[model samples]
Every structure is written in structure tokens, then in C-alpha cells.
Target: MQFQFHPLTRKEATELISWRYDRPLDIYNIKVDTDSLQNTVDFFVDPKNSYFAISSDLHEFTAFCCIGADAQVPGGDYSLDALDIGLGIRPELTSQGLGSPIAIATIDYAKQSFSPQRLRVTIAAFNFRALKVWQNLAFLPVQRFRKQNGGNEYLVFIRNT
Candidate 1:
């Protein structure tokens, strides 16, 4: 299947905020308001920040993911040497083998787009599927830490590009 990446517009962000989805990435729990997503989109639209979403060629959003410069990484100050990334596919599409390509493509895109030496993703320990995906994609576990949301520890995996 073919795919394209769209830089979400402010209006699109607001619209997407209301689009309901019963899954892990639900906006409600994240406290993502119109302004937050709007600001996110604004940062993504800026060439200085490396963030984007990948969609199918049919114009459907097959996945949502982003890569942040060091300054944007959750735990530390911005550093040009590393990038923080996150991703989630529609729950309905899980276990369909669509992840491999999208994950790899997103990584390649981030590498080329940001020119960072390392790419990182913080995945929950309970997400076996994601762990497998990251491993299959060659991301090695570098560190593990607890999350405030629960007792689950997040594994910080890294990929050298």
C-alpha cells in the first residue's frame, strides 16, 4: 500500500481532537486540548522541529507518529545528537504486518529529516506487540524507567541511524 505524510494544520488538529477512537492513544486521557494539538501542529509545521504524521496513499491516516529534537524529548534538555520518537497505529490494524514498513519508513524519514545520530522511543513494558515491532526494526533497549501513569515501566530503546 502507498502512503503520504501530512503536516497537520491547526484546523485539522482541532477536528481530529474530536474524532473519537477507542484505543490507547485516546486524547481524553492525555489531556490533549484543542490548543495543545494546535500547538503541536504548529511546531510540526515549523522546519525547526522534526514532527509529522504518515498517512496511506488513499488519504487515510494509517498511523500517527512524531520525532522530537533533543529539546523536545521528555526527560532532558534539547541536544542535537539524539531524537525522541513515538508512534501508534490504529488498534484495528494491529497484527496485520503493516507496522514493519511504517515503522521503518518513519525512522528513515526522521533520520533524513532531523539528521540525528540516534532515535529513541519510550514503550510500555506491557506492550508486547510494540516491543516486538521495535526489536524487529532493530531498536535495542538502552534503559528502563517507571511511568507516573502506573506501575508499568517504560523501556527506552534506541536505534542508530
Candidate 2:
């Protein structure tokens, strides 16, 4: 599918707040208090977050992406000069072979937008589906670590841009 990316909007952020994923992958769901929709909306709409909404058909919201610090997970070694990438494919769209294209597009976007020397991604260890996609893009394993809050294990991957 052809892809178009644009700055995230309040309406899109509001809709994303309702996207729920199944177990294992459910960890990607937004975790803010549902009572304060404004808080979550503010996150995606904020200029510093670098959030972008993705779509092919004008009427469909395919995915959302973020670059930079907001894309980095806590407790990861972010000392490198790589722009991080964060993406979420609509729950129903997962495992349907869409990740690679979206990811390639995201990397191209990151290059033209950030021009970082490298790129980085931190993913949940159990998310082999995502890991495989990143690996296919040549994002190599850097390290495996738990968050300072001490939750599930996560692996960090990096690749030269």
C-alpha cells in the first residue's frame, strides 16, 4: 500500500487512545489514565514528541510513529547518536506483512527528517514478531535489559542509517 505521513493531530491522538491490543502485544497500548483523555492527546499532539500519523487511504488510520527521545524506552543505553523509532500497526493489521514496508518508510522518513548517524529501537523480548521485522531491516541486537521500574525484559537494537 502507498503511505502518507503527517504530523499527528488531536483527533488522531484521541482515537489512538482507544486502540487496545491483545496479550503480549497489549504492552504497546497507551497506559495513561483513561479519565484524562487530554493527557494522552497532549502527548501525541505536543510538538516536541515528533509524533506522526500514517495512512494510505484518506479515511483509514494505518499507524502512528514517533522519533527521538519519546521513542526511547527508559533504562536503555541511549548514549549513542541514533534517532529512535516507535511504531504501532493497527491491532488487526499485525502479522499481515505490513511491518516491513512501514518500517522502510519510517527509516526513510527518519533519514530525511533527523539525519541521524544511526537508528535505534527497543522492543519487548517476547515480541518476536517485531524483532524479526527489525532484524530483517538489519537492526542488530545491542543489549537486553529491564526497565528501572523492573518489569518485563526488553532488547535494544541499533543500525547505521
Candidate 3:
């Protein structure tokens, strides 16, 4: 399926604030508190960042992804210069074999938009599905560390762009 990306609008950001995934998947959902929403809106509006709403050929929202440097992930200096990618599938679309496509689309976007030497993704250690998706995309495990906020362990993966 073909995917098209567009700037995330204010209305889309508001709708995202109320999006909630199912039980286990909810753990990976973006925090929708007032502060978080404000930050998200600010990030989305920044042209320097590549945060966007991805839509299918039918113009239905399929996922959200940021393919730039604004992603905060636990890692070392090696990631500082790499294009970082963060993504979330629509709550209703999770586990329907969409992960790989979403990841590929984001990576393709990063490659086209930034032309970075490398691409990096930080995945929660327990999020096996996401890890698998990165692995499938040829991202190699680089490091494992704990997030300062929640102390949850995460793994950093990277691949040459």
C-alpha cells in the first residue's frame, strides 16, 4: 500500500491527544497530558522536525512518525549525528502487519529528507514487536540503557542510511 505524509495539523494533534491503544499496546502510547500535548503540538509545528501524519492511499490516517533529531532516546554520542526516527501506529491499526510498512516509510522519508549517514531507533526492551520491525529493517543493536524518566530499559538500534 502506498503511504503519503503530511504535516500534522492542530486538529490532528488534538485528536491524537485522545487516542488510546488497547491494554498492552497502551504502554507505548504517547502521553496525552496537558503538558505532553503542548509539547507535541510545538514539535509538530516545527519545520526543522519531520513529525507528520501518514495516510494511506485512501487518505486515512495510518500512523504518526518523526524522522528527525527531536526524538529523546537513551544512547551515547554516536546517535547525536544520526537521523532518529520515532513512530506510532494508529491505535485501531496496531498488530495488523502494519509495523514494517510504517517503519519503512519513516526510514524512506528520513533518507530522502535528511540524507543522513545513519539512522537510529530507540525501542523499549519489552516491546518485542517494535524490535522485530527494526531488525527486519536491518537495524543492528547498538546499545541498551535505562530511561531516566521511568527507569525502563531500552535498546538502541542503528543502520547506515
Which one wins on lDDT? 2
Better of 2 and 3 by TM-score: 2
C-alpha lDDT score of every prediction, in listed order: 0.65, 0.87, 0.79
Instruction: Kindly list the per-residue Cα lDDT of model 2 for residues 23-142, writing each as its tens digit.
Output: 988888887785777887987899898999989763378988999899887888888778899988888877888899899889998899888999999999999988999999999999
> Sort by TM-score, best first: what order?
2, 3, 1
| Tens digits of per-residue lDDT for model 1, 1-161 | 76566665555444444555455434322346655775655654665554455688634766667666422324423333568887766556667888777888778777776787888877777777778999988899877776555555678887888
Residue 144 lDDT, candidate 1, scale 0-100: 73
Candidate 2: list runs displaced more than 4 Å. none
User: After superposition, which runs of candidate 1 have C-alpha atoms over 4 Å from their true positions?
Assistant: 19-29, 32-49, 69-80, 148-151
Candidate 2 accuracy as TM-score: 0.94
* Worst window of 10 by summed lDDT in candidate 3: 71-80
TM-score of 3: 0.86
Best by TM-score: 2
Clashes of 1: 2
- What digit string (tens of lDDT, one per residue) describes model 3 on residues 1-161? 88888888777766666779776667666686675778877767676776788889644777888776656564434435777888988787878898998789888987887788989888888889999999999999988888877667888898998
Return the lDDT, model 3, position 90.
78
